[model samples]
Target: MGDFVKEILVKPIQYADEVVKLADGAISFRQDCLEVKTKSEKLVSLLRQAARASGDLYERPTRRIIDDTEQVLDKALTLVLKCRANGIARIFTIIPAGAFRKITQQLENSIGDVSWLLRVSTPADDRDDEYLGLPPIAANEPILCLIWEQIAILCSGTIEDRTDAAASLVSLARDNDRYGKLIIEEGGVGPLLRLAKEGRMEGQESAARAIGLLGRDPDSVEQIVNAGVCQVFAKILKEGHMKVQVVVAWAVSELAAHHRKCQDHFAQSNVIQLLVSHLAFETIQEHSKYAIPTKHAMSIHSVVMANNQKNDMDVTDANYRNNEQDDECKSKIQRPRGCQRIVKCTIW
Candidate 1:
């Protein structure tokens, strides 16, 4: 019985340690790549914490920690792949074709190795239905029905699953107004708003994109406003990753375009002020893509100012009308003759 328990528990702990070491090796291999290094370091930190926590005799590895570790590793792998692809793209433009091919092959092999390690480290029970809710629909099921299912996953899935589901929903909504509308109608806004506010980096990124895409639909704008999306977007614009900030700004622009209420909310939330501050920094202005969204935000600011001025004028006009009516009423009233006569005598 002791041997069986050791085999069941000790081996898996050893496997997890091996996985952590492999992740550390990958981190060292990509030390020069800051983005890759940052992500890998996070994975290492999470795995180490998990390992330490699991070592306690009275405790078992919690599902949340395991899920979080896997998610971090997944994000690290993605960053590694993206860094390699970017390197390849840059090298291909300057290097000989043979050299390019060799470099590409090396990158592919490296990515494959990391992918294999990730798979080996992942427990066999980590299926889509485990992290996500409910199994996928049968092949015979109608496509239209899948929308609700996807929304359900977005609402209830684990962090990583919710991120993917949000990305999938955005992809479906792109160029499809009907799908965007459906997402709003199906109660997707609340979950997305929460994700944008509290999710991990990837989750926030996907949620921002999804919200931005959905904001393009006129009907969805009010739903987004009621979800307090302006506050989330404002926070993202101020503190999110640069790529995500651009998307959030664009979404703000879209929401400002057709909805007066959204515009007011954004203005009141100080999103316009944040964008204006961004514009003052030379680094932000150097990125041309950033300018596009900043421009849109400034446009919203202009509209807000114009609206305020108009409101002020309207109030002034109303006050003037009231004053004029009061003067007319005073003119119609007869003054006492004795008072007038006393004034004439004093003057004489």
Candidate 2:
């Protein structure tokens, strides 16, 4: 009994120590971007908090504490991976773009090593069992293989896995129009919509971006709408984290641009009002492009006008008048002055 108690008590402290080491290693990695460095620092702070919290446990840690610690570690690791990916992408896009090949190769190797370390370090009991004993599926098309792999990860992997997979899918869809169509045809939309509606912070952001990218294809617009993406986007826009809200805004805007039915879906979901409310926040005002809200307002306005034109009966006159008033309000609302840069960015 004594030995057992000591083992139980010592394990958490040991795990905490490992986490600190991992955090240190992550911070030591070259972070040329300010965003990457800030994220690494924030990750270290979270790890410290988690370590302190774990150290307070004299016995075996409670379920709640273990879960909480796992959540923090998952978030930290996801941020680190995301920062590295972003840095790699940025290097590829830099002007003159010298040494990008070597830089990306190094970054990719580092990311692989870190990801492997994180997977192994995670407690066995916490690991998802669905990946066990599954034979890998082979495909002729590399993109199809990637889409399938990400779908599998999203379906049954941990939060970190889902987040990483979603981000990869987003990048894949963004880089190729054909890939986006293939993703839609391969039943990627359902899983992506599921993640967007029910995933963690990073998962939600990636899923929204993937959906947005997929929405760029006009053929996928109705499919996305049918998957209840508009409702999910409206909810995310209203209450999600800042990064997610911005992505969701862009996504819904893309969907709205594709077809009139998508616009109708957004109007029915009250997405216009939700977006208008987002304008009240300074963070949203800064990060969000105005094209989304501007286009959304126009979509809603068109819907109301069409409704009024169809319903000319005396009994519905009052309803038409109400809609007209709403349209007036939407029309009179001016775009934010800071949106000039966003417009230019979108155009380019």
Candidate 3:
């Protein structure tokens, strides 16, 4: 834990402290900057607690959470510094209020992650209790607690429960880009991806769609892709319920269009080729009113493929029967089966 903490978490903690100082030091955008500062301060405290945790601190997922937290802090610092600039520097900075809001959302997610880690880590933070309660939510982002609740349901709930949770997640994510990124930062990708693979049809579709919407930034994209999104998508496209395939198809397209690098990922995953094979039999036309978008287009492709195979078999059987009939005709003629047969042929 000691070596891993120094290597993986120390730098991120430093970055968080830097964000705190920079946000506090910034003169302009004070209120917005302070929002970031307060969040960073909380993150630092949480991170320190996480560092002392006795569990497998070096695990890949743990490292990822800490690493991602570091990234948000770095972003916060960059934004705060830009806000700190004055005169010509300030002119070039062009800081926006929404930028701080987005960073804050990410930071709160980091705080939540560390808090969760503290609860699960061995010997627990409290030494007496095996589980620690979740940290309180920010007053400004009260919806965050609800978002976290749905994600929790997605993790361990039944099929119908996960499906409903997925729909709730999709709705919150669709409300704004910030909320989408927030879901990503809160470790929603793992369970969402799991549900996409194993849940009921309704759950799979919602889970797949939510994943696409979650790619609100490069960092989130990295998290989603690294969570095996491309592989999962490729598998589904090749052999999932046709309706689920359509949802995944739309998901892949949305992420690719949102990021050029994501397009490269699909090609690497061979999903692009899979999509082409699908398109050969399916039309591009789509309608939105169905339970799954593009349901009609894909349904036709399945029907067409089935019909084509049946037609080919039918033609082969017909040719075989015709050859048999010709053989019978020749045999009868050769055997001189009846004088009436010969007479009929001559008359014709």
Candidate 4:
């Protein structure tokens, strides 16, 4: 591979032409470019070689190639981005994630600024479960953060800074939107709930709806309820948009089943009726089965205890107790005279 890269690097113009031709498709393009068919196979091999090589010999040449846009290397960086954007997937098992981030940072700098580079780093929503199994950085923080920050910049930033501070203001949450520790602490649920309450119609609507989903987590609701958020959600339900209404109703149902105080308050506010009405249309009988064990267990215990009291059967009577056994057996066979009236009242 090093020999191949050396061969290509010697004639950089030819390498550059192939790289650009491969990446020149339209932005909305969805086709896969085969590495074996194009220079990607060779280029990926070269990247690995450059990574493995030590000292200034590798750095100087790699920097020169990355820095010069007039030749093949510049086009090669663009090609990597295009290949990634078109959904050419790979396992990072052979290559470390940090190496990928570093290489990608160089490519990001080389591309100047593109609106859709934002979308490239944003992992597919359906891919979240797969991502969560990855190491911490790849799963939790910078991947989504990079996407958010990039889109924020591309959508609203000036030429100098290139970020939408307003979008981050209204929508962003810290730490990959985990909302666990944050929602449990003081002031955790406030920002999202406030966004729903006070942000612009679109921002507020989305924020409010998100708050409703966040409410499903028990710790989050306990903190939000303790902070007096239910009333605010109730008001939002009365006047929020259709999406907000749907989310708020779902949120209310979640709150209702978990916190009795919240359920009572929601009932008094009349939101429970609305949530119940919605549930009637969407409910599955299996959904109610989750809570059945606790109810069934309580009912069985109550019936057993009540029947035992009404039976008047001695746990150890003359039929079971032996007089010759000991004083312990005699004591066990008799109830104390002081308890006679109580036993008669309960058992007879």
Find the candidate with the highest TM-score and give its number: 3
**Candidate with better TM-score, 1 vs 4:** 1
Instruction: Supply candidate 3's per-residue lDDT for 102.
Output: 87
* Candidate 2 segments whose C-alpha is farther than 4 A from its true place: 1-139, 280-348
**Candidate 3, residue 264: lDDT:** 76
lDDT of 4 at 151: 36
TM-score of 1: 0.42
The per-prediction tally of clashing pairs is 0, 0, 0, 5
TM-score of each: 0.42, 0.44, 0.46, 0.30
lDDT of all predictions, in order shown?
Answer: 0.54, 0.56, 0.71, 0.42
Tens-place lDDT digits, model 1, residues 151-240: 545654578867877888788778588878877776778878888888888888788878878877566788888889978878987887
Per-residue error for 141 in candidate 3, Å, reads: 2.5
Query: In model 3, which regions exceed 4 Å deviation?
Result: 1-140, 283-348
Error of 1 at 258 (Å): 2.9
- Candidate 3 residue-wise lDDT, 21-138, digit = tens: 7776787888888888888899899888777763444243466567788788888888888878888877777776588778888988888877765554432223453343443433
Error of 1 at 50 (Å): 33
Report the number of the highest-lDDT candidate.
Answer: 3
Q: Among all windows of ten consecutive residues in candidate 2, which has the lowest summed lDDT?
A: 130-139
For model 2, what is the error of residue 292's alpha carbon versus the real structure, in angstroms, after optimal superposition? 31
Model 4: residues with Cα > 4 Å off, grouped in runs: 1-178, 183-186, 257-261, 274-348
Tens-digit lDDT track for model 2 on 1-348? 234433433443344344444443442243333333343344344434443434222121123233433443444444344334445574553222333333333333333322322332343345564332211122235456566556656654667777887999988998998888878876678878888888998899899889988987556888888878877887886777767777777777667666646666777787766765554444443443322333344665445544444543443566566765655444544434442332222222
